[model samples]
Target: MTLAPVEYAVIEFGDSTVTGDLVPALTELVETGLVHVIDLVFLSKDADGTVTVLELDDLPEGTAAAFAGLEHDIDDLVNETDLQVEAELLSPGTSAVVIVWENLWAQRFSDAVLASGGVLLDSQKVPQDVAAAALAAHLASLD
Candidate 1:
């Protein structure tokens, strides 16, 4: 079987935003063949500098509802070291989620490129504001 390219992302949330707010979009991504969730971990830092890591099965009722009926390929791929990194970056009173996912839709294409002996270069996600600015500038120049 061809292996999907894996990617990890860390989402930091302010005290106001909760996991529930972000679930719908992520569910849609998985449903639309964007990616497969290999592991999802939520970390909350207490005022006493304690970070609690919650796996899918350990999620709170309200938080678990976010994954309502969504497919979770839970592989427990994110280990303690990953949690430690998240803990270090999270604020004492804030929360964050670390996600490890595979780009399922890109597997075949990536395999083909590899088969052709092509060296993969860099991949970067353009910041939303920068992309918007570039688009606006191009449109203005065309007008």
Candidate 2:
């Protein structure tokens, strides 16, 4: 099955902040058919942030196991090392979510980073060429 392309917002916060909201939003996105799953990348200040991605497969009733199969399809099409892989896994029907925690959401996390002074960065959505290159590169490296 072909995937859909979607857009999402990522909320970044400090250590041990309000991270519970992400799952529900992702679930909603999946339920609405806006996206199959969300790739959650966590960015933090000086602490050296690590990106952790979770595909929301616990879909609401009525929908097929599309998300269940998506993980493998995405993994096959995109290289694990490429950032675009996340975007590629999300079909045109799906979208990528970039959660950057800041004021209003996580004051402590926002304040801590500001005190130390860290900036949030956004990676551009996977363009066609970039996605193609990543796929091509993955295929080539396989040999």
Work out the TM-score per prediction.
0.83, 0.30
* Model 1 deviation from the true structure expressed as Cα RMSD, one decimal place: 2.2
Across 1-143, the per-residue lDDT of candidate 2 in tens digits comes to 22233334533343322234445554564455444432434222222323344333322232223233321223222233544434333333222334321112344565666668776565366778999999999999999
Q: In model 2, which regions exceed 4 Å deviation?
A: 15-18, 47-143
User: Quick one: best TM-score, which candidate?
Assistant: 1
* Predicted structure 2: clash tally: 21
The whole-model lDDT of each prediction reads: 0.79, 0.40
Any runs in candidate 1 off by more than 4 Å, and if so which?
none
Instruction: Please list all clashing residue pairs in model 1, or write none if there are none.
Output: none
State which candidate has the highest lDDT: 1
Q: How close is candidate 1 to the true structure, as a TM-score?
A: 0.83
| Residue 101 displacement in candidate 2 (angstroms) | 19
